[model samples]
Target: MNATPCIIKLSHISFAYPGSDVDVLNNLDLTLCQGEKIGLIAPNGSGKTTLFHTIMGLSQPRQGTIELLGKPMRTPKDFEAIRTQIGLLFQDADDQLFCPTVLDDVAFGPLNLGFSKEEAKNTALETIHELGLSGIRDSVTHRLSGGQKRLVALAAVLAMRPKALLLDEPTAGLDMDVKETLINILNSLDISMMIISHEFDFIHEVTHKIYSMENGKILTDEEVHVHQHEHVHRHGRHPHKH
Candidate 1:
């Protein structure tokens, strides 16, 4: 079989926050193929979010290199042009949604990318429609339920038509129905995905591979068993890990 092209690459990467003694990520190397679905497993403070930030260009590494789409990454502008190619669903829905109305919030990405008002609105409308949020398009963003808010945030990223989607704790705090809905939505999307979640069962449902992280390093990368919902994690126990 031919080797697949990498959509994302990281080599010997390390990062440390200001005033912090420990590195959040240390000498980590990762490569993501064009359409792979990967579940990132790790405990809280295990550098999962830090890794996502580095990939999204929200933060810079103190050492080593990151390449997205075959080019070295530096600066917000380099990531800005690449932003439309990637969608990030932050763990906190409140942090992701800022505009007054759902339509405007969802349209933010396309509008900033220079799409006309009509085009932005139309794209946002289509995404919301796909996510079954048409009824809430004109509603105030802050007024939506937690699950609905997550959907709206997801729609905002989906509106950009990204090639890779990174979701942080997507199933966290969500009820079973909402979790199932989100799982179905993720399963239906065709793009590559890197999901960070403590919900092992849910991860098994939507992803084909697992990348386990511990102590600021990647421990294992393995294929998912189609019929297995439970994962034997080396990380500490969570609600679903029993």
Candidate 2:
């Protein structure tokens, strides 16, 4: 079988907001292969969201390169082409849902992408039904609970049929049951994903590879090992490797 190509690549990247001397990502190097479920863990203000913006082409780095699906990304239009292939779930659902009603909100992307009115509406309705949001399709978005709003947000993105997903704090305010539902949805999706979150339990349940970030720099990058099974002793004592 032919090998799948890398979906995201960042090389020696350095970035800082204008007028701010601090670099959010300093000479950062990161890559994601196709079908990989990766978790990015970092504290608040450690550049996790900044990295997402850079990857989404909402922001640019002061130095270095970023390539999405083998195409060099430098302009908004360039990012737009790749972005259609990548769905981003923002940390705040409110940030993503601007339409008055759920159906309208979910149809936003496809409509903007030049889908016919009928096509966009059908896509939105199908996604809403699949996400179990059909009952509330006409409801006002702000009136919904946090978890429900999150589902609606996810449905909106899925309606676009993105090839990859970048989710930021997907389960932030979700209760156990809703979180589990989200986990199941993540597991079932065929797209490549990169999730940013602080909830270790949530991240470990969804992703196989892990990257730790601190002060805008990556501290650890490796395949994830479940803490529960990783502490076992191989002999009379814990085995040490160097």
Candidate 3:
């Protein structure tokens, strides 16, 4: 049996937008073990992104508690400390890459963490090299292709060396080769992760376990497999596939 400790624990988490009558997350509970790769799948508006926001402390929950790396998270101060231990990858690479050059963008986080200029640059270069992106170290962020931008965005997050990663739609707009590259990189990393994606094939490729969400709740049956078949209806013996 795997004896990895829990890196993230959310208990009885309930969240609702201010002045809204509905709760996007209701008593949601989740746990991510160290070195575990988990995937969450759900249709649009199923509260998957909301769950990420809550975990990242971007959104406050109405009730319940969150523990990160064995430390309880309560106030903004707690989240401030927790942020360094958890990296978040936004669905859109453009949202995270803003610096003039890829190296500068990847170095931003280390600089903010008080690493010396030389140290930050070195860390960024090492991270870029690890991601096999050294060729574009000085490339303009906006000019890079979609796959390059995505890898650079991820390099920026990895430079911080977070213990866990929360990725939202990491493979949304990638071609086959890019997707394969991402899968290889993710498989090589020894970090815990909670990935949200609609691409079942991609999810299955990288994650060890999978869960489905519905109406702000995670379903109990975690064992999920993708299957395709046609269904025959009684209406004049019509057959259709979904």
Candidate 4:
């Protein structure tokens, strides 16, 4: 609701996976407001995925509180009740896609959420068609191309009609046309989002503000900008006045 200012709030959160010596997340604090789109930038092993897991309650934090969609999420049950409302697109398409076909994978979420078979099928079909994936609805999930797999993974998430989307490397291995279409689709959505990507340009274009994660913390930098140089230059050439 617009009345609720924060869609996600993690305060003083600290977490460490089982058998880990150190905390993957160390007193991290992050918030996503309603209708806000933000980007998370960090290298691999920087605990970006851990942070998302903590928010989703896949991994519980040893300390601190998590509030989602204006309510506290302290237990697995609490998080489960709202998980469908906040879609999480996993970084690995293989991890996300397990059903036999593209249509099955896409409709799985809605089915789990109590949509009738007809309703779920229709939703999946509409989502697939909208994403230009109609041709692959019957295609084998594990046999699709890398780019197609990524897009199908996204289609699965979008079919849930989440109020908030947590996308991890959604553009990885996508083609130029697919990337552009993804960008346009994301920009058109009126939902809260926190995208984690190493592609600076894609993040910059889709999110209103960008933050860099360091040492299990989100370093706020809303003014992140990327500049382009139009002039061409040759490799291994030095620049000097004639």
Evaluated against the true structure, the overall lDDT of model 4 is 0.89
Number of the top candidate by TM-score?
3
Q: List TM-scores for all candidates, in order.
A: 0.90, 0.88, 0.92, 0.90
> Relative to the true structure, how large is the alpha-carbon lDDT of every model?
0.88, 0.88, 0.91, 0.89
Instruction: Give per-residue CA lDDT, model 2, range 1-242, as digits (tens).
Output: 97778888998888999999999999888888899989988778889988988888888898888899989988788987789788999999999998999999999999988999999999999999988789999999999999999999999999999878999999998999999989988887888999998888888889988887765666555533335334445664655763
Off by over 4 Å in 3: 1-3, 220-242
- Residues 1-242, model 1: lDDT tens digits: 96887888999899999989798999998888888999987778999999999998988888988899888887788887786787889999999999999999999998988899999999999999999999988999999999999999999999999889989999889999999899889999998999999878998889988888866777655433323344576675756534
lDDT of 2: 0.88
Across 166-231, the per-residue lDDT of candidate 3 in tens digits comes to 999999989999999999999999999989998888888899888888777887444455445555
Per-residue C-alpha lDDT of model 4 across residues 114-195, encoded as one tens digit per residue: 9999999999999999888999899999999888898899899999999999998889888888889889889978899999
Residue 14, candidate 1: alpha-carbon lDDT: 92
Clashes of 2: 0
Clashes of each: 0, 0, 0, 0
RMSD of candidate 2 to the truth, in angstroms, is 5.2
Ten contiguous residues with the weakest lDDT in model 3: 220-229
